[model samples]
Target: MTTTTPAALRAAAERFGDGEAVADGSVRLSWHDLLTAAETVARALIAEGLAPEDRVALCAPNTHHWVAAVLGAQYAGCVAVPVNTRFTEPEMAEILTRSRARALFVVGTFLGVDRLARLQGFLDGVTVIRIPGEGDRPSPDVIEWDALGAVAERVPVEVARARADAVTPDQVSDILFTSGTTGRSKGAMTAHRQALGVAAAWVECGEVTSADRYLIVNPFFHSFGYKAGILAALLSGATMVPQAVFDLDRTLELVERERITVLPGPPTIYQTMLDRPGKRPSTLRLAVTGAAPVPVVLVERMRSELSFQTVLTAYGLTEAVVVTMCRPGDAPETVSRTSGRAVAGFEVRIAGDTREILVRGPNVMLGYLDDPEATAQAVDGDGWLHTGDVGVLDADGYLTITDRLKDMYVCGGFNVYPAEVEQVLARLPGVSECAVVGVPHERLGEVGRAHIILAPGTSLSTEDVLAHCAERLANYKIPRSVEFRTELPRNATGKILKRMLRDG
Candidate 1:
């Protein structure tokens, strides 16, 4: 039985051997080749002086390098910290500093931005390894990805293999940072057992198999992409075909060319495909999606038009991924309306008068990294992780997410916390008071709307506010609309009533 991620990788290599493991564009890696590459990366990191249990940050989009780098980090008994590629330089710098990452595996260039060059100011005492991207530029200080083999020569391969074998199930495997109501991102630590356990649950629930060719369109920074996309494929021996960016034309071309079997994405992806004027035939058979609400029509059309045999919606947060998922044969209404029942040894219950969703399971995160007070509040004494989303459970035990308790919203399948946006908005020169709220958006499920009150005699245009946000925040977190007001509505206790703002 596989208990850890590295073990799962090793088992896949041993069992599948020459079977294709990753197919990224022209680069194809068999299971055995993947293992050899990951081992080389492990040896390189060991030689680079990354101690066991130290943190290593990866800031890149979905690619073959991401898969190997993360697995290599785990093989060396180090924790992998996946950084969001959409974040600004300052945001990325903050995460690197907060995680205390000893080394960074970053892309040289992506989307016309020189990631490594932009981060040069903040990478003190940290080893920088550059991954290949679109624009070709080399820095003397940064180590090239291909040079890992040379670095590995300094450390014996046997030592790296022993380190991979020595990895225990209880060791912290990854630190996934998620934003909270406090306007700060907290690193949610997950053990090797927890990570693999959730991936196994997702694989079983989705009915993933070795013959499956999974198209991972989601970004690797998110849990759904890494745990459900990569780790689940590792456990099930599915071929991973990662798409770094989600272009409708490219997605359709890949679907037809690669004979992709499992395609999991947000509801918008299916809707867009269905609306395409000239849709291509696809081999898509299974889809497990949830971030925004899945409409019954969308679910039906996915089966009818997109040729998906199974369409499942699931509910999960950074703390406990794959908490609830719809089964293969569930009714369309059940699949569309609810997030299915609890899986992976998790027990779900609606707690308190607020109807907050509470989950308890072996897969619950160990804790927020290095923040005991925040961890105590998140996970109670009874071991229930207080998922700050309001939900309802029907007689059949299916959970329907109705509202959010954290004032957080999902924008284009990414979590956008209002507090985080408000914090950024407050930094604007003319902004005296501001409250951000999630408003309905046709395409992006929900988007932020900033209600601002400027200082006396100070004026600012919407363009200025948006421009300021564009520089500091990710694209999804930037408010879609800005409303200037004289004052914000508040209760007697002086707390701004965000519900009123959202309602208006």
Candidate 2:
């Protein structure tokens, strides 16, 4: 369970050398292949002058190289900054600038690679390494990924040995950027101990084993993906299947083909898959959803249609990974109704008037990198990370997420949970996805408005949707108006971009 050091990967490589590590379509890498590739990339990075604690930005989609590059960076004693592949040039530029990254690795053919290419000028002093692609030649000043690995000398065992001697659990591992309701993104500096502790706790809570094959659909840029998906698999010696993007059909195929047992994703992903035409994988034993609220209807449909053994609802954030998880033994209704109790090694409490959820644990991020003022605001002097999510913990320890503190609204002296309203909208026929935000109101102080994406070939008028909500929810909880869109604005991890909705 102690996976604080990069040596854990070495351990896995030695123990499960012939076991599968990653599979992307026709390409598959066993533990031996993965370790060799990581070592090669690590040597290349070190040869390029990256030192211990240096920041290496990774902007690749989910691919074998993505995992390789991360493990390689860790092997070289460098901190990996996983960039959101969906970021605009300006956004990417801001993160690159903020992290003060010396090098950037990009997957070349994803939907937004061109946008990254457009920002090459913005990354003037930084080295840009492009993963190979067919239609495009390497841009000027950009180094080909394969070329770097070919010429770079392998890291001598002595170097790794020496660095390993000095590396400690408290050393910073990742700087994850989280955009809260206000201001620019803050870089949450997660330490090696914290990240590994989260992975350990997750492995324990989920009962993960070496026999499990995990399909990692969550973007590695986020802590949920890094600790929950990658590190958890590493600690348990489970095979990891990486998908750069979440395509419903392809995910289903991978699940069935790989005989994947453990699946972790947001509710949107599972909902999309249930709507797709396919047989659920027989080997899938546990289906877990988090990062957003799970609609009651979606949970019902997943169980009734997919026939998975259990559906678990989890809750966590960039600062603290896997804070709570509903156990498989919990009733299906309980799992569907709440985000579950606090996982091992974490304490959760509801705070102040709005009942914002606060967390304290070894898994909490060390602090925001180089921003003490922001860190002070986020983590109290006593060490709890203010999650900013409002919720209540029942006497029996069940944690029910009520709403995001920032997303709550007062409608004529009544508090309204936007998540509650959005959940209702999501259940309406033809609604594929939805986001709710509060807009200024003269009499009520604030009122809710919904931005919605309709399912393909389905449409509903604003009045119709509102009418449907009236049947299920109190009038104050219903959205005052609804806006239709082909797709809801989302961040890289498929989280609805409420800032856009608020700004609009």
Q: Total clashing residue pairs per candidate? A: 0, 1
Estimated TM-score per prediction? Answer: 0.99, 0.80
lDDT leader:
1
Q: Using alpha carbons, what is the TM-score of model 2?
A: 0.80
- The sequence of per-residue lDDT tens digits that candidate 1 reaches over residues 109-221 is 89998888889888998988899988767678988998989999999989998999999999999999998898889999999999999999999999999899999998899
Q: lDDT tens string, model 2, 87-135?
A: 6565678888999998888767666246446676778777777876535
Which is the leading candidate under TM-score? 1
lDDT of the candidates, in the order given? 0.92, 0.77
Q: Could you tell me which 10 consecutive residues in candidate 1 have the lowest summed lDDT?
A: 273-282
lDDT of 1 at 64: 97
Off by over 4 Å in 2: 154-157, 295-297, 408-504
Report how far off residue 379 is in candidate 2 (Å).
0.7
Worst 10 residues of 2 by lDDT: 408-417
